[model samples]
Target: MDWAEVGTLVALLAAGALLSGFLAGLLGIGGGAVTVPVLFQVLTTLDVAAETRMQIAIGTSLALIIPTSIRSLRAHLAKGAVDTVLLRQWIVTVPLGAMLGGAVANLLPSDVLEAIFAAIALVLGLRMLIGKLPFLLGRDLPGRVGRTVAGLVIGGLSAIMGIGGGVLNNTFMTLYGRTMHQAVATSAGVGVLIAVPGVVPFVVGGWGRPDLPPFSLGNVSLAALAILIPLSMPTVKLGATLAHRLTRRQLEIGFGLFLLTVSVRFIASAL
Candidate 1:
């Protein structure tokens, strides 16, 4: 990349990292919804092939989310919000699902991935906009079989969408009568599981692809991961602080709007 282009990419990545970090703290999301779209645009500017750009974006987003999710997880853990029992139950299945999801994503067309992301984002957006689900599944979380099934679904979808499992996991938990705080905290753990194992398949899948940018491994862009990880680290703490201060209702509305915006952007890109 030219010096000017490098400078521009760094600036954009910094901005994206900052925003994503804050969101990660505030909402317990891995912030991939925001980062993926921006990275896709940036990668396009670098003339990355259409076939690989979306995969790179998703991989890089998941990679960057590792540190962000860990930080958020720690923050919530301190506050006694995370659900250890639930996390234990999901540990095995979630990673398996994530790996499978990444493998699946490697085979799919970029347009299809974009459409899937858009649809998932729309669901999350509407949930946020409404502030609460209109219905409840039950008063308590499901049993082993149910959780395993949920874990697979969450892990798979999270890998495909390049998200930490926060958004969906939180929604699921809340629907089962868990508080938002607990759901968000636990979702941070979910993000770790998704991002960690999820990175491998993508890297393997994209290995030796001619269209990838420099310092890339498979579909994961090392340059973007480098830029996003450190920059996002501190901001996650700031976001978590802010999260603790906000009313649940306020957080819901903000997250909902954010999802709507990102989903619409992805949909537009696909068209």
Candidate 2:
């Protein structure tokens, strides 16, 4: 990369680090919702291929979230908020989903992928903003069916949107009667699953596409990953540690508002 490109990457990473850490600390989301758009802008500025930009953006964002998720996971674990049993079950499902989703992400037209993601963000956003999350609706069961359903959709979308699927997972759990702390902690674990498989297939599928950009590895963007991964880790750690301490009602209010905003922005951009 050129000096200008290096400088821009550095700036984005810096901003991403701060924003990521704050979001992690506040929301336990590991910054994918934020990362996608930011990476989208950076990939565009880098003259990444029009055809593969979203794929690269999503893949690179998941790649970057690797360290961040580890950091946050440790923090949540330290606070005794993590649900290992649930995480163990989900970790099994998500990676499988990630690989399948990655393949599907590559096969689908980019427009279709973007519209579906935007729709998810819009619906989730509107629900949160209205303070009417179905999770808080006081419903109860073992959630087997719900978990399976969430896994499929979250896994698919995680690959297509280039997220770790924690946002969707957390939302599902929260609505399922899991407390916010448990949901956030469990979501961190979900990130680890998606990041690994998500990056691999994206790279595999997008690798030789003639229309792709210079440094892309399949659907993943190496340049952005090089800068973003290291910078996002500590912030995620800080965020998870803080999540264990934040009040539930306050966290709910804050996370809801943030998702609401990000959701709208994503929908607007995709539209």
Candidate 3:
């Protein structure tokens, strides 16, 4: 790539990492909600094939999520906001679902994936904005089997959308009568689960592919990972701090708006 191109890419990625890191810390998200779409836009300017673009985007997003989730998890831990028992219950099924999701994503087309991501984001955003999306099953988090089902759904969808499981987990936890702080904190643990086993299927699925972008391994972009991880890691603490300061309603509104914006971007891409 030329110097000008390199400069632009650096600027774009740096900005994205900064915002995403903060969001990850604050919302217990993996930052892939922002990173996946942003990275896809960046890759479009390069030589990657359209067929593989979404795969690479999702894989790379999952890879980048690893460190971000770790840092976010620690921050939430320090605040004593996490629900440990819930996290433990979700650990196994979440990753299993993530692996399955990665495998399934490889079978879908790019536009289809984009559309799915956009639709989910839009629904979530509206629900958050409405401030009361009901969970009719109960006012308490479910039993082991119910949790396993929730974990599977959250993990699978997150893997397909290249996100941390935070969004769904946070909403689920809060709907089940947990405080938002507890929900957000536990969601970070969900990110840990999703990102760990989640990354493997992506790599394996894209192994031996010939048309991948430069500095790629399977579907993961080494270049993107190198830039994003470092840039995002340090900022997570800052976001965590801010998260604690914000009121529950404020956090929900902010997260809702962010999802709406991301939904629009993904929809635009699909079109």
Candidate 4:
């Protein structure tokens, strides 16, 4: 690519990163939802092969999530909104699940992965949109065994979908009666758990592949990470601050709308 073209791409990515960072803090999502799609488009522009493009995007997103989640978690921690007990319960199991997910993602087709992301997002979006009547499993969170299983599922799916586990974790927490603020805060911690271990399998899976783009480490693109990380970090605090300011119902509506939009976009891409 020419210098002008590269500059344009960087500009586009920078914009996405800023938004992703804000969403990370605001929603505790670690910004993978935005990062993955933006990276996929960038890869497409670089003429990356369709088969590997999604994996690269997902891998890069996970890598970016590590720092983004940390920043977001720290911001939420200051507010005393995080649910430490729940985070502790899932720390071990979630990482294991993320590793398993990364391995599974390597075997799956890109379209299939997109479909999974879309389907889950659609369901969660619809659930959140039905604001007045939440679909609850019980008045309290599940017991240890149940929480472990939930953690596993959250980790695995988030890994595959290139998310920070916030979407799934938030849903899980809220279904059991936790407040939206608490769910968002705790999900930031979950993102840290999922992303730290999730990135390894992707690195191993895509290592030295012929189809990869330049400056790649397995399925991750160093260029994209370099551009995204710095731009995304500062905005996380801004988003976290906004998250605290918003009302619970407002937060739920916003989250629902964002998920639904993402779902539609991915579904179309998959098709």
Candidate 5:
């Protein structure tokens, strides 16, 4: 690419990293929600094959989550808002689910992945937008079997969608009567769980593929990772700080609107 194009790509990556880092802290989402879409656009600009673009984007997003999630988790932990017990229980099941999701993502078409991303975002968006409906399943989280199931689903779906499991975990916790702050904080921990193991399957799946972009390690783009990781890290604490300042209702509305916008964009692309 020309210097102008290179400059543009760098600029875009920089902006995306900053925004994502802030979101990671602000929403406990590990910033994959922003990273995936931004990486996809970057890959497109580089003329990456359509068949591999989404996979690469997702894989790269997961890799980016590793440090950012850790950073975000720590920030939340300091606030004593994280549900450590819940995180402990999900340790094994969530990783296992993430692995399964990465494996499944390898087999699915890009459009199908997009659809899955869009559909899940749509549901979560509506749930948040509706603002404390009386449809909660219970006043407390479910038993072991149910919690295990929830963990698996959260890990798998987050892996597939290139998220940190924040949105899903946050939604799950809030529905079960946990406070939004607790849900958000716990979701940061979940991101670490999903991202670390989640990256392996994607790398293995894309190994030796001929159509990948430059500087790629399997489906994970080292170039993107390099740019995103550092630029994103510093902003995470800032977002986490802001999260503490916002009211639960405000956070809910903001998250809901963000997800809805994302869902619409992807749904249009998928169609």
Candidate 6:
């Protein structure tokens, strides 16, 4: 690669690392929101083909998330928020869900994947807006059934979309009575479900895809993960510590705005 290309790649890595670290704590999300968009945009400018762009973007994004989630999970665990029992259940299902989801995504055409992503973006955007209401905060709906069903939907979506599932898990857990801290902590566990099985098919399905990027494991790209994971680890702790200091609404407002921006971008990309 030329120096110019090297410089741009480094810039992207730096930006991705910083954004993932910052938002991981601020939004209680896993950072795919930022990484995928940035990678997509940057890779496109580099003349990467669309055929493998989304796959690598999603794969590399999730790759960073593996470490990011662990770091973030550690912070939340320190604050006494992670629910071990609930996390156990996800362990059983997430792998299967992620693997299946990746396989499905591989089989589908670009338009289908794009459509699904667009739909998810709008729903997430609406969720971000609606979840901010006073009624939505700390609201308790009593039932294990509801939580279980929620787990299914969230996990399935996570694998299919190649996200860590933190946003959905955080939102649902909060709606089901988990405090903000608990929700964030618990959501960290959601990445395991996504990263493991999801990655399997991402690689298997994208084996021979035209114009695939360098050092890719299936559809998942390695270019960004090499830099992102190491940086995000310690920074996640930073975000978690900061979360304790920020007011709940302050965090929510920031998170909501972040989601809104990402949603708009995804929708536009799909269109």
Q: Which candidate has the highest TM-score of all?
A: 1
Q: What TM-score would every model get versus the actual structure?
A: 0.95, 0.84, 0.94, 0.93, 0.94, 0.87
Residue-level lDDT tens digits of model 3 in 1-271: 8999989988998988998898899888998988887888888888679888888999999998888989899988988889999888877899999999988988898789878888988987887787756554467998888888999999999999899988788778877888878888888889989988888887888889888887888989999988898999889998888888976566678778988998998777666
lDDT string, candidate 4, 122-197, tens digits = 8878876886443788899999999999999999999998899887888788889888899999999999999999
Candidate 2 accuracy as TM-score: 0.84
Better of 1 and 5 by lDDT: 5
True-structure RMSD, every candidate: 1.5, 3.1, 1.8, 1.9, 1.6, 2.6
- Residue 250 in candidate 5, Cα distance off native in Å: 4.5
Please tell me which model should have the higher lDDT, number 5 or number 6. 5
Backbone clash pairs for candidate 2 read 24-239, 25-239, 135-175, 206-218, 207-218
How do these models rank on TM-score, best leading? 1, 5, 3, 4, 6, 2
- Preferred candidate (lDDT higher): 3 or 5: 5
Backbone clashes in candidate 3 total 0
Query: Residue 213 lDDT in model 1?
Result: 86
| Local distance difference test values of all predictions, in order | 0.89, 0.70, 0.86, 0.89, 0.90, 0.71
> What TM-score would candidate 6 get against the native?
0.87
Q: Which stretches of candidate 2 lie over 4 Å from their true place?
A: 1-9, 131-146, 248-271
Q: Report the lDDT tens digits of candidate 2 across residue range 1-271.
A: 6898878777976787677655654565657767777776776677766677777777777777677777777778877888887776666677788778888877777667667666666665555455426436445424666566667677777776766666677677766577777878877778777787778877787867898766767777776676666666656766665676655555455655766665666567765
Clashing pairs in 4: none
lDDT of 6: 0.71
Most accurate candidate by lDDT = 5
Per-residue error (Å), model 3, residue 90: 1.2
What would the per-residue lDDT of candidate 5 be over residues 158-211, giving only the tens digit for each residue? Answer: 999888998788879988999888988998999999999999988999999999
